[model samples]
Target: MGEFKVLEIKQSIFEDNDKDAEAVRAELKEKGVFLLNLMSSPGSGKTTTLCRTIELLKNQLRIGIMEADIDSDVDAKTIAEQGVKSIQLHTGGMCHLDADMTRQGLKGLGIEDVDLAILENVGNLVCPAEFDTGSVKNAMILSVPEGHDKPLKYPLMFSICDVVLINKIDVMPYFDFDLEKCKEYIAMRNPNAKVIPICARTGEGMEEWAAWLKEEVNEWQTN
Candidate 1:
């Protein structure tokens, strides 16, 4: 066998992406825009939760949405109906978006007048966690059907998030999902993570989630 060079491509990619992410953050901060990177497994009700959140805070804050997916424009279209600026980002078969990609999406969404820009990241528990999207805050949705052990399974995802939303709580009785146990697991991974239980469909516990977001945006823009 011939001598081969090991380039450490993965590490290099992350290093470059991290640098780009900081630039993205600085740009948002300068514009007084709060960018949120929201992630979850597919069908976790992210869109529905976003819709409910928009309903709650749209009046007070200028909101924008960037819906990223491997394909399809469904989520972007859905968000546009809420009367907020929205753009769809196709990942071109990639599972997650890096900081440069996020920056491009932000530009397309136009953040000059936006106070809160939410990036609905491509649904997945793995790659999305590995890439920094340059958001002010990172949040993920864990629905009841996904099981409480997710935090234990995807520790990186849980540990990186500033907040975790337990969606589909209204069906907890049928799913055997333990809310307390989920929170405990999350704490094990990230002691500072805030966990919110909610049913986006019924608007249950959404007020608290929206309140948290509003406070975060206010703080990001104010300070």
Candidate 2:
């Protein structure tokens, strides 16, 4: 009976998480807020990509961000300077941010007031893949310096991602990162995933990303 009680407790927690995630998504939909959960490994330039995206879309859309980090305030401060409303989430050394933590962060984000809310997950490739933060879309950025094997090595993130942003394309000549191979791997894992090559620093692929986002938002608006 004791073991059965613990199992019941665990089951209840899992069920509760799923229910909460659904509720959060429904609420965001009603508010017309398109939430995107961005995930990537450390140094993959997730924050830089976000800042660039926000800058590009700010004039057209009310952009907001929920920045998740283990300790450093660098990313949050830098994002806030760009004139977008961003809430910093300090995970206190947790490798991944669960739906509950994200719920707390979203409660503080005032998401209903914005058109789009981007959740930048703690810079982690693997663990973040195992969790859902009640986002409308899951975006993953893979930098050229990270090598092409990332999709194969960290399959879950790629598999679950709605879109794959290939960052640091300018560094393609310097690094051995093959964009074609990366696309192939991503396709193998997620055959339907849209892959966009981008140089976040130079804003090369910002337009394409923005266009994709606009399409998604338009569809949401109509449906």
Candidate 3:
């Protein structure tokens, strides 16, 4: 107790991260690359959904993907097999990717010719929501098996997302997930959130998702 020093470390860290995020956003805007930060819990079908999405839009857009994980390059391998530009990002022991990490991943992926670059963030709802990745839009997927009560437990994730994809809708009959109730919960927390129910495996409900993405990318490019 010789000398007591109080440091507001958390606030300072967040402020610095925000500045980096803003710079990343400006750089992406100038290059006309629409980066999407996709967040979700593990087993949410994010990879399958992305494969379907690439199939739908690859002909029209030059797409690249950054598959982020705490370990392993499995998802990146899966995406590369689809013949799109893909890069694997290892976060070491970190749970989330901050703006600087995202910028590094983008550089590795080489976004110069990429029209739409998607960062498939590490599988989690909490840490990913806490950091800004500087994407043009934020999106998350909540599969039917995960239930309709997730928003009640993880409000911040839902609150920050521009769109929420309700994946594994094909298994809705087997699960007790209430689609309308889930939508209600998400809407209560995020009134402007767009919830799209999709079955990525069978390609159901993907058209609507693709259309929304097309519109979003077009808007981002023009304005």
The TM-score values for the models, in the order shown, are 0.95, 0.93, 0.95
Total clashes in model 2, counting residue pairs 3 or more apart in sequence or in different chains: 0
lDDT of 3 by residue, 1-223 (tens): 5898898656666888899999999999999999999999999999999999999999988999999999999999999998999999999989999999999999999999999999999999999999999998999999999999999999999999999999999999999999999999999999999999999999999999999998999999999
Q: lDDT tens string, model 1, 34-153? A: 999999999999999999999999999999999999999999999999999999999999999999999999999899999999999999999999999999999999999999999999
All candidates: CA RMSD (Å): 2.6, 2.4, 2.0
Q: Note the Cα lDDT for every prediction shown.
A: 0.96, 0.87, 0.96
Output the TM-score of candidate 2.
Answer: 0.93
Which candidate's TM-score is highest? Answer: 3
Lowest lDDT sum, 10 consecutive residues, model 3, at 7-16
- Tell how far residue 95 is off in model 3, in angstroms: 0.8
Q: Spell out the clash pairs found in candidate 2.
A: none
lDDT of candidate model 2 versus the reference:
0.87
After superposition, candidate 2 runs with Cα above 4 Å error? 1-14
Task: Report residue 148 deviation for candidate 2 (angstroms).
Answer: 0.4
Which run of 10 residues does model 1 get worst, by summed lDDT? 5-14
